[model samples]
Target: MPVTRANAMSKENKKVAVIGAGIIGMAVASCLQRDGHDIFVVDPNEPGLGASFGNAGVFGTSSVAPMSMPGAIRQVPKWLSDPYGPLAVRWSYLPFIAGWLARYIAAGRPDRVERQARALRDMLGRAVDNLAPLVEAAEATAVFHRNGSLFIYRSAEGFAKDRQTWDLRARNGVQWEELDAAALRQFEPSLSSNCTYGILVRTNGHTSNPHALVTCLAQNLIKRGATIHRTAAIGFVLDGDRLRAIRTTQGEIPVDAAVVAAGAFSRPLSRQLGDRLPLETERGYHIMISDPEVRPKVPIADQEAKFVATPMDTGLRLAGTVELAGLNAPPNWERSRILLHQARGLFPALRDNYPEDRLSLWMGHRPSLPDSLPVIDRSKRSPDVFYAFGHGHVGMASSGMTGMVLADLIAGRRPTIDITPFRANRFA
Candidate 1:
């Protein structure tokens, strides 16, 4: 496959080390490779086994609304009170996260939310288009489905409550159609009749298998002369604001430039580069049911329950939830159980109990920021060192564009979108 230079600037190629093998890291590598850069990826774990492996897989182009929307704080107290609620926080971790919570709440102010939404729209709106080239290169185009997604509500009141969010999406050029009970049922017969309202974002799409998609891209990179280092990136060896090489557990690997796409583990590396970002882990969980009796035709998000039921090649994936328990906390299986209970309610045909072999549960940390935006900028200390983490919940959907933008920055070309909102020093 010939690399496309339409988005490339100078033909100069350099040794680029992408730190992290998740979807974001691989996507960045793919774009850099497309621009003819010598690329290598670094990670300790198997590629794509982190949050990218277990996300809902929705392209979520319409998901421009920041997580910290207006009136979101009022519901936090109620959400915290419920153990099985969509949001949870380990009480012990609250003190450590208090400052982040404050900033999160402040980000919800109407003015800030508007700016955040526009920025998110610019990046996520072209998700599928941006990812098309990489998907083609990987020969995994079949892994993606453009059948659209549903946001169904159990009651008219619940639907009305989200009007502002829908309005925000509309203002950001997101196209969606309102569906009543009959229409919702006709669109997704597998859903329970309790869902009375829905909004179909026809422009959105989803990956049938996120892990496979990322692995294919990684494999493609390797086939194209890129290397994958199965080791942890500990630090960097710098020479007066220029990255000389990356320090790893195994030893140092010389590189002309580096990217910190390490997801939840990127904070310390950023701090090492003189950028103290307020990056936190929003621990998310998912349950996969293999050979489900019933599955939605497309991804369906229960607006009130705050989880998504996505039909995947492996089976049906019920994924969503925000648990702020930090990165080191043990897995909370109870949260996975809550998803099972919610799934039964969403899909009445699903069995109350499934054999352990038929079910798989996962918990991974989503690298999140208070304002629900990612840091896709060069380091304050070195232009060669770029930051591309803190994507929060939309990493899979936004990875393609993030990669293109990073490649443009690295190649000294203008990014296709405005990246000011994603600057590392925004919090400062």
Candidate 2:
């Protein structure tokens, strides 16, 4: 039998430590536990309160387009000049991030962008299917629905300008339906008449509550005999090429194998493991209304405005934006306010006089790599240490598949996809 196949049937289970309790970590812990491995998760903050909490709630499997495209570099100057634009990088922090910015722009090369898109599509194409079993096992199916997603454009010209993106999506085998103004309005009556063109991805879907799903997954892992330590992972203890234990604020916990899915904080840990990844944070903002007057049957994205409005169980969530200010800088709440204004423009029926108590404003860091792909490979320094972070905007959509692939790597099995693109040594 193959080494991985032998391990699968060994009957000797190993203790695996997952160093994060967000959606990614919880998902990985759940997968490893199901495979009969002893699982332990460690994190300083409460699980599900990070980026996993404030996401747009859309599981965009068909969203395989990379943010870095042929013309993206030229748009950066204008985007940075406009404070309220969809993408912005602080001028003061430019000098500090100059190196990463250069690489980010370089990834926009035509050939590179296409390669990134294909890799992302391969990993996220089966997002809903990959997550279904886990969602059902956790009894959280109510949160996720395959109602598909809608992208509305302000005009035919605007939609025409995005033909390149649509073409790329088509090349990746993404299914969709184009709707005229009348059909679009009938499909999502909540959308204002200003949105004249609509394209609905028939295979896409979203969650009504992202935080609830994360909580459900975490709870399910705990119920399945997995231990969760509410402590910060400070470092790791390695014995030669193998990891002996993970050092945390509470204490050192021994482990036979480990996964670092700490989101934006995975950079320092990666550096400690001898691979200096160019991991940066895209601080994303969201505004949630507790009781909305109007609700969309499915999630809708204003293609021109660069924001999404997803009808959640509690209310409608308006979320999007890419702000680069590193990890320690304070959030600019104005960005969240801007999202509210843009959302109102898209949906005119939203009452301006809604109670202030019904609103929730949030900002969280999204771990990202320049190439717009995550590191789902093993650490170059430690044989037993694996990496699974830098997912950018697709973290939620890709979490299930990421967990499955990482589990296979941990079990010494060849993953179903080519993970070479996500290797830690890529940056090196």
Tens digits of per-residue lDDT, candidate 1, 1-428, equal 11122243243888889999999999999999999998878999989998899999999999899999999889988987887789999899999899999999999999999999999999899888888889999999889888889998988899889989989988999998989999988888888889888889888889999999999999999999898988999999899988778889888888788999999999999998899989999998999999999878889998888999999999999998999989999989888878989988888999989999999999999999999999999999988899999999899999999999999998899998999999999998
- Using TM-score as the measure, the top candidate is 1
- What digit string (tens of lDDT, one per residue) describes model 2 on residues 130-175? 9888899999999989989999998889999888888888899898
Question: Backbone clashes per model, in order?
Answer: 0, 0
Q: Cα deviation in Å at residue 244, candidate 1?
A: 1.1
User: What C-alpha lDDT does candidate 1 achieve relative to the native structure?
Assistant: 0.91
In angstroms, the error of model 2 at 151 is 0.5
Q: Which pairs of residues collide in candidate 2?
A: none
Model 1 — TM-score against the truth? 0.97
Error in Å for residue 250 of model 2: 1.4
- Best of the candidates, lDDT: 1
Against the reference, the lDDT scores of all candidates come to 0.91, 0.86
